[model samples]
Target: MPAYEIDGYDNLIAGMVQPIVTQSIIINQATDAKFERGTVLARTGFTEEGMWVCTIVNSEATPAEEKVPVGVLADEEVDATTAQQRATAYVSGEFNRDALIFGGTDTIATHEAALNAAKIYTKRVVK
Candidate 1:
């Protein structure tokens, strides 16, 4: 007889507002590197082939836009190490703060205002 195995999934979103808003964005291979579910994103304010490009939001970045949190990555782990890839992002929604990934000296306190401004709310999930 052969042995079998099973896998489990993790949910990053804690809650959502009515009519969830999402956008198809291009992950910048040179900047983003890799993407995991619930990774915060920011617009690079540039596009390639007519699609908007984005990368992980960095609080220490010099660019104003790069320091702003615009969306949350709503996909499974994406390997953008080799080439740019298209993925979906939650433009506006409620998410679990514990599950979110930050970059470059960013913390929930640092980007709280920016996240609120963008209509992306995060909740403290007790678990």
Candidate 2:
């Protein structure tokens, strides 16, 4: 399992925070192994019951790498893939528009500054 950290701003103001994750996600593979604590995730879209399924966010270029982080997964356990109350919301915190997160996959083609975008310290995926 890969582990990602929630770096950058820790002392975020209450208003800048948003609910990027949902509580209790029902997924196709419900072993619960995919939901590692602190791993960033994306949605598997909406279900018939209007629930958004959660999965590990995959990198576009690397595929095995992380993607635009929606938020961090809280430590949990559930066995059913298509289960109710199987997920918890991992929220996002951005202090301002300049807020940096360490998981962005975009790169500039031309010359760029070291701090071209908001940056957060990220721990790479361990295969």
lDDT of each: 0.77, 0.40
In the order shown, what is each candidate's alpha-carbon RMSD?
A: 5.5, 9.6
Indicate which candidate wins on lDDT.
1
Tens digit of per-residue lDDT, candidate 1, span 1-127: 1111224534566675534588888886774478788789989865746666888899888877788888888777666888888888888878777788888878888887888789888888876
**Taking the tens digit of each residue's C-alpha lDDT, what string does model 2 give over 1-127?**
1122336643222232333323555545645434435444555567878876656554452543234444445544333444544555444432221222223453322102222231212222222
Q: Rate residue 6 of model 2 by lDDT.
A: 39
Model 1 per-residue lDDT at 2: 10
* Model 2 TM-score (2 dp): 0.42
Candidate 1: count of backbone clashes, pairs at least 3 residues apart or interchain: 0
Q: Clashes per prediction?
A: 0, 4
